[model samples]
Target: MNLKIQKISILLFLFSGLSVFSQIKEEQLILDKKREPEVKKIEKKKTSVESIKNYPPEEKSQNPVEYSITNVPALSDFQTSTLQADDISPNLKTDYYSNYVRFGMGNYGKILGDANVSYTLENKLEVGADAHINANHGLQNIYAWDSRQTSLKAGAFLNGYGEKGKYNVTADFGQENYNYYGIYALNPASDVDINQKVNAFRVKGSYDHFSNEYLNNITFKSSFLSDRFGAKENKGALDFNFSKHDLELPLNDVKMNADLGLGLETQSTDFEILNTNSSSYFLGNLSPKVTFIKDKSYLTIGSGFTYLSTNESNLSLDRKANKTYWFPKAELQLAKSDELKFYAGVDGGLSLNSYASMLEKNLYIVSDQRVTPTETKYNVYLGIRGDVDELIKYDVSIGHSKVNDILFYQTNNLFDTSIAAIRNAYDFANTFSAIYDNGTKNEVNASLQYFPRENFNVSGSFHYINYKMENFDNIYNVPTFSAELGAEYTLLNKKLLLGFKGFMASTMVTNLYDVTNTGLSTNYTTTEQLNTKFGGYVDFNLSAEYKIHKNFSIFAIGNNLIGGNYSTLQGYQVLGAQILGGLKVSF
Candidate 1:
């Protein structure tokens, strides 16, 4: 019993000690909790002090903040989606035809035929042939004069492309036949059975080499031409050119280019009149040119050195001449834009006047005629060309040129006049001769083109020329003013096309004389002079075509629709109003 009581007392004492320690710990926790609020308060005060110290002075305003909204837009109806499709269609493409045939017949027993064909071989060769024939019986006004013209031409060409160069070779042959039937107005009773024939052949070959280094490119060409009339001519030429494009220059923003050309030509002509007379010409030309280009301006300084030698069986003393000519070429594009362009230039050259070429211009030229080259000293021109709108375009130019040995057409006055009746017949042959005159020419030309609609087009041109001859008072058969107008319209989805054209020329002078002396002479002492005038006439034509198929069509043409009697040349009166209908086939 005593031991149990002693243990109880010890346990009670231990429990009381434990209770005192817990009370002390609770007191310490309460003190910490009270200090925590004070510490947090101090920290908040410190943060506020720091923010006030760093704040901007201007932002520390004492007034109360206010906010308001004014002038607000009123809401209205709004569309969510709006879209549309294009209404315009694309343009139509044209179909090309390579071969065609046409045939027609008109009043005054006129007949016309034309045909052309072409073939391609192996993608490298092309061959083509064409033929045309036109004939007309004598008009009522001009009796016993029947005229006809026929031409046939055929050609073949080969093209070859290589890595560094390209080459082309071509061969062509042509034949032409025509009648000189303009003699009836001068002598109605004379027999009118004269014909002229021409046969021509040509072969040409050329090669071009390309390079990017010093020598930019080189070109070589060779050609031969032969024409056989009662008079025959044959010519051969060889040409070579060395060129450097875009060569570097010493000046800034300036580029340079150079070209050097060498040429050799030989020609021989045989004239068959009363006796055969022959002439041979040898010509050589060397030309060197340099061009400087700066911005929109270009200047070319060049010179051509030519040597010509003629061996005429008749005239030997004055058959050779050597000439050196300097040409100054310059162009300034004063203003260039989408609507307008202004430019000026000067150009000059020496041109060959061959027998064949002269005869082509004036078919009535006498067979035994002298021919010489023409020299154009210089020509200065100023031009302005531009588009007025999407559908209209215009070009105007004025130029002046000085030429030496310019050829003109004159009537032959040297026919035999022994018999009075027969002499009158031979005197009125209405043949022409070529004469040369040194002259100065001033010209003004203007052209306008308009496309008012997709299927209609109209164009017109005007030309004015003033010619002054050094030796003669008047130049014969040369008009001073000329104009041409043309219009075309298509309808019914391009199935029908209508066209009209008109031409007008001012008066031209011609000299009529009594041939009393033999041997061609323009001397006033030997012939009685009579001055005549021609031209100052207008001509109109209308045509229409209806396409029955894509490759076939029918056409009708009305020529000289005004039915006015007019003469283009001195003694050749044109046919009156006539209508022609034809069929066209294309492949």
Candidate 2:
């Protein structure tokens, strides 16, 4: 496949995979107790961790067995609940610290920061604000296109408690800035600003009923986003549920409960191009469920319905943006004892493919593309979780799902002479495009946590997934298998702590288009083939913190201790042997 020499060099992009998925290797800090995501998503109608208010949060990487260091969606909506962070200093006093702050700096121009402050206005009223920063200038002596990046997020909230219910409202702002540094950086392109910036704002309100007839809780959120380019998105969502858990039933060893939910989603986007018109979509859901409870066991059976409507917002192929879907929901749990249990279930739903959620998966996705919803047709799963001994616990689950309009990521093909001039800056083979397909996904998630003693702990987890799609050759950029392990220990009367963690993933693949002549010069054809193969890598980090006074502590962290060459994202080189240290204060 040759002849279109100037553009066919896209084949030259057949570079070896850059590195293993990498995140700063360090033990989870800021209250080592592992916690689930506080902000909820409308992915499904499953039970999730209860949201907490004004508490010292564990490190957040971004959740499933949610890691405190990186937030990558491995199983889409299949979340693991066993990624426990060890509490190394069980003897340390923790209740007095009401406000917290921390800051640190490291090589590669890396900066780390987290702060949360709250004040009690009266016996039952409170307010707080929080901020987080994670940024790095560049991997020195690496690429040439100014590979600098930063993520900044901040938010504030007010809360009120009454005899009937609890109320809270919050406002948040965020910004992400990065350069489209890629192999294209080697070639000179002076007309565009390689730097990209996206800004976001959000408002949220929730009511938790202390006592009500059928209403349990309600939540609503609104968001707006804009990029340096002409791309813009506005979104709003409402989710609420009604439930009753203790109604007597005629069946033996059984009780009945009514579980119902209602949700609404609205979004609009401006793509900034004339031919590609702006679009909007709205999705609403209704779920009805019944659950039965027995001794240490329970079962839930239910179904859901989703209605979708769109305006000029259709998927690129196959799926239509406007449609209605019916799905199943059921779960079974059998427990032999408090130490062991078995579970299985089948479920499905529609996931809102908003601009913000897509960017959460791949930060480099093009900003000016049509967005739609992903339909998870069905998911059947089975698993067991139990305490192996007094010091150990384990959970393992396997699931298979039929999905439609599944979202995946791939490199945006570089422009060729057949097309008009580049319309955006992300066109240099540096940016990614969101791809959707109908397919099946098989996944396995296993996690183990050890608590032999109060001052030391160990945890490990493994995830494997395989994808077969109807419209694509291979799943791009996603690892086939990945695993993480970490441990921490405390000594010196629980004043000093040390910990280490590491992760690894299988090789990844990406395909691009190549032009070839079809016998005659006047006719031509294009074929898709593997153009890049990213190599797998293993990396780890070490951390230590020492408390000097009751209200103050100093800590140090080191990443990539082995100096491995890896990029959490393919083509992006991570800094080698990074070290960051700083102070923590509470008042």
Candidate 3:
């Protein structure tokens, strides 16, 4: 072993396996500090800041999940539930935020791969990589498991920051793979197999201080998720949380804010479908958020508490107590962009699980009688962005929603065959629920732009979506719509850039149990209830560049341009248009 001593013995065996995983996470944090008094009596109790009132000003960026806006972060705590950052759109583009590497091949033999890479320094370190894979087999496949079906995913990320802003750090890693084969028709000569593998990681830190109007903020986030199957045995998730926000009012328009957060999580499960064996469950959530930003208009309210415990094997929980959640979010903005701007927002929440006090619970007890905990929800949104001169621009959005309890699914059972009646005793009660007296969703979006000259261009977009669960059961009530138009033309005088695009989507309302009986432990028949479908497509893109001098120039691309045949879901089918080209150099 003399190749540099075999790379120094693989870097000393990866630093002795990261020092034995940091000494087994410091001996599981010393057994969670000896269960710190039963986790401090189940954590919950916070209120101070002169008994609460004026305190709005902390929002200088924090927490950024890919979507960048000066490095996002700050909704004044509530541990990000979703929504806000006003639909950041810089001419909306997707390649999922490219750092780029893409491969393609089509003409009825579809195959593609995608990649993203990242690195940043000087501004305070960062590292990244993301991947995607696509496969095809439906162009004519007599069989061979419909001729090959697969999906794969990969990921990695890291970040660091410090320089008067105090400190911060982040890390992540991920993986996923899926495959299916069984010549349809009840698995003719079935070889039916299943697989799952996942791993996740996270770490966060924050701190800040200021004087003059008094400001202070603090944060800490932790995460871990893991899964392994092949005979199942490795399944775990552990999370830790922390948050604090303080602001001294009078920064402007009657602003006020106060935020506090607390969190803890745990889960470990062993998997097996056809043989029977299930256990390991424990969940806990505690949240607190507060806000009041009144310039364009803002108001937020919040609350939370949830704790679940399980330890059986088959199932349980019709009532065993502990579950409380309440959330509220509100927003109002009218930038009136010198041209036009508008936005409206809303968030609602209510959850109570004491197994639903249906007169002291227990309607089917055992643990969670297949689960339906309890829920009450709400969501609403409206937006209108601006820009006119300088060659036109626009944005429009509308949304609506409401959902409750919602647990569903009923068949496919994913090859488990109910495990031979689990020792012969029907009604295992693993799936079925219907407290959806409320379930509605609506969405409308629009994007448009035009550039008269300066390189000639045009753009378009339209979308409509609706999902209603009026009365639940065997569900059905979906409506979808999509439209896209594009154009780009840059001449020999400006190098060369020619493009054309067209897209269409439909269903206008359809169902079949959203593409057939849902699986993965079957939930009351779901997957949106057999994805009823409709299709549309049209694409064409071409790029060319020649500066044969200066910063070195030479570019080329031709993608999908009219190879129509659509199916974004429902037996999934995508690929008609295909072509890939690449080459670039710049300094």
**Candidate with the greatest lDDT versus the true structure:** 2
Off by over 4 Å in 1: 1-96, 145-172, 184-192, 204-229, 238-242, 246-257, 274-278, 292-297, 313-318, 420-427, 515-526
Decide which is better by lDDT, 2 or 3: 2
Return the TM-score for candidate 3, rounded to 2 decimals: 0.24
lDDT of each: 0.57, 0.65, 0.39
Worst-scoring 10-residue span by lDDT in model 3: 26-35
- The CA lDDT at 289 in model 1 is 80
Name the Cα RMSD for model 1: 37.9
All candidates' TM-scores? 0.72, 0.80, 0.24
Specify the highest-TM-score model's number. 2
Q: Residue-wise lDDT of candidate 3 within 294-328, one digit each (tens)?
A: 55444556655556665545433223344445555
Each prediction's RMSD over C-alphas, in Å, is: 37.9, 12.2, 24.9
